[model samples]
Target: MNLSEFMNTEIVAGNTLWRITGLFGLLLVGFTAGKLLKFILSRRAEQLREPRPIIAATLGAIGRAAPFLAFALGLAAGTSLLVLNGASELVGTCVAIVVTLAISWTAICLVDAPKAWMTQRAGQTESKLDDMLAPIVSKSLIATIVVLTVVQIAQILSGKEITSILAGLGIGGLAFALAAQDTIKNLFGSMVLLADRPFEVGDRIVVDSTDGTVETVGMRSTRVRTLTGHLVTIPNGELANKSIENVTKRPHIRRIFNITITYDTPPAKVAEAKAILEEIMKDHEGMDPEFPPRVFFNEFQNSALNLFCIYWYHPALWWDYLALTERINMQILERFNEAGIDFAFPTQTVHLAGDPSRPLEVGVKGS
Candidate 1:
């Protein structure tokens, strides 16, 4: 057969040979073009990444999604040449679904660019609000894209208007909302937490009985890494209701020290003890100028004299405060010993009516 005759020959499903060739030819061409474009964009994106990160990231995202989109488009175009009478609408609908999904997929991929940019920008700032908000915004955008994609696919498949579909979805959504009350509450609670700025990520906080460092604030729950190294997930709804103590926000740590001395010590020695403590705590390490160290002989008990001391340490760092406390205690011990002062201990004395040369006499009464 001549080339012209072969071109007109009947193929499978009554499609002419030329038409079949054209369909396959378009498919191959699309795939090849997609691959070439992806390679070029990927290389160029790499070169531009340092100078123009946002643009580079966007191009990279598109490059990653090129193959799938191009293949879907090619299939849609090729199917138009087929002579399937009743199946035409079905095929078209299927292609439309694929294309919709492809576009949505690309959109989702594109979200990565801005999401990363937001994350990078957030990291540069001192405020943690941006850090907490960036992920939420990115996830919300992706979710919106997915929902819209599903709706579009539904419209294509059912051949229904968007208004009708949305009306149906609204009724379904109401039932869903009613069924998922806790989830909704948690979502709103998360929003409240964000708005209130109660605590940020990495802040050590005490919520009710749970004391931990905030690890993450998510839609439903907040994860806390406890002191004992346990991870606790608290629902945002409940967390919002609880009182929160943000330990990380404290300006200083206050400490009250009580030093006891033996009662046998004379008034002069008691005064000296107080003076010694005042001298030992004077301008102590980590002490805040606004909250100077105070020392006084505040009380007298049966066994000892109570010396009260109050001091505030700036910055509220646990390890540094502990070191300062240890040094202060050692200094007090050394200073008191040098002054011949004895630390008080519990003791008792018993007296007898008749002992040694001492005796007791009682008067007799006649009735």
Candidate 2:
């Protein structure tokens, strides 16, 4: 048939406009069906206290697949009608567009589904970092897939070789690397932080005296909530280079208290003081039994005998440690008072050979 006759035949047979209308109608139906399915699945899932994860996963899969399936069938029907109308080239182009769109949409939906499942599971487990990491990983995967897909689609449409494009990129590799140096460093730093797990969210850490609880970890920087109630952002690269002290992970803390008494206090009294300290340590609940407290007469100063008290306490918390130390200090004071041992303060005695009279005679000597 002639081109004009063929076109007239297609219009008369309703193959041209009918196919386009059917395609759009099917897409709308798919969207409506997907939404309804999601609602039903969500309602059913809420009925379960601890819903089986597989149920959510199945629902998510169905939700993602239903639209694509409907669209595919619609496009197939539409393309067949167009081909019957002798619009073979148009059908081919439409098919290619549908395939590309389907691939992109399916990839995005697949990425989103797993991410949602993981996020839900993480929420159930109460993991703080999951919320931050899940979106990042999901988006990164989606971005990479999109970039690759676009490149591939471009190559397919233009009939250009991908190898040539890659070769051209290789030529500019050095410049690209130079520009992305910091980005690469941060990315690697983030990976190292995740693998090593030096600190997790909510861990109290001291990095070069910037003490805080980790709030979030990102690709470029880590956020911490300081004791002073301010947020601090440290570059991941810098954080990796510095020493990190995770105080939250420490099981016990060692504490030292030094006291000095007048040198005139007898050795027997010093021994008695030590015994009293040992008793106090034993009675204190915070003291660790595995590492008992010990007191020693360390040195003799000009006016005082210095005693060292070394102990390990179950420092489960920062404030608890301070409280325990205060209790020990108060107990030590009470014990010293009861034993009549005085805590020494710096003192000086001026030995004067007729000092008061000599001060008055200074003027007479000058005369």
Candidate 3:
């Protein structure tokens, strides 16, 4: 018998029987196609070792999708056959199933594409931002797709109008608004942080009292990997309002040191001391020449003369700054000892009514 004759005979008996047979045949074809596609993709992935996760994931996704696409097309073809044979109800059901499968497949593929792209790109750079954001983006895409798929399924199952559902949602929207107030605030805060570019991942920053390298910026919170080796999660809203000190961006660091010498040191010696300090700073390789060092005899007290040394260092790394300061301080001590300048210590002077050798006289009789 001819292909057409067989299909006609099957449909003439009962649309349900014909549908069952056609569905099985389509499933078989889909299974075969899926297996073949999986084999081909697996071989290709094995050949390309780089971007292993992305390549393997993408290939797996494509392999899985092949079967669904084949099944959808098969169902559509079967539905068309049923319609030609005047089986309206069966054809309608098949059409709905096919449509649902098509929508779901499309959504899955759309979500997967972005994840694959991000995964592939993440291999190229050392950016902490890219590493932090990749998984977030992937999960968000998946969530959005799932939500859309559910909405589509609801529309198909309930046959409820979209406008009616939207109207219902609008009526109850106030509750949702109230529930998500903080969430919305954080969302906007995150956007602001991104646009303002205050600091980025791997940047060393001080937010209020918390000092750390920014690990990630997320939907609600910004994570910092503190120097103390702890992960701190700070709300984006609070972070936006707080004072942020971006230490990494500064080209130079200002360092100030105070030296106190005995008040007995003469003014000429102080002048000599200032000259020595200037020479020391000038000769130092770490000091920035653009902003020269200043040595000021700031103040004089009963016990000590306070001298201030202010200098700047290029490339403001903490370790480098500390090392440079230590060197300068050591040189200052050596220079002071060599020049016969003594650092001051607190001292006290007392006035006595009588000498210890001469006892106090009793004045009661005269009084």
Best by TM-score: 1
Q: How many backbone clashes does candidate 2 have?
A: 0
Q: Residue by residue across 1-367, what tens digits does model 2's lDDT show?
A: 7765644454434565555556567667756775676567666645542566556655665566556655665566655544345666556666676667677766776675667777787777855567667766886788888877776676666666998766766777678889989977887788788777788788999999799998878878889999999999998888888899998989987888788898778889988887888888774777666788888888888778888888876867768878888988899899999999889989876665557754433334443
Cα deviation of 113, candidate 3, in Å: 4.6
Worst 10 residues of 1 by lDDT: 354-363
| Rank ordering of all candidates by TM-score, starting from the highest | 1, 2, 3
lDDT of 1 by residue, 30-59 (tens): 788888889999999999888888888899
TM-score of 3: 0.71
lDDT of 2: 0.74
Model 3 lDDT per residue over 283-316, tens place? 4666666788999999987778988889988878
Q: lDDT of candidate 1 vs native?
A: 0.89
Error of 1 at 230 (Å): 2.3
RMSD of each: 3.0, 5.9, 5.9
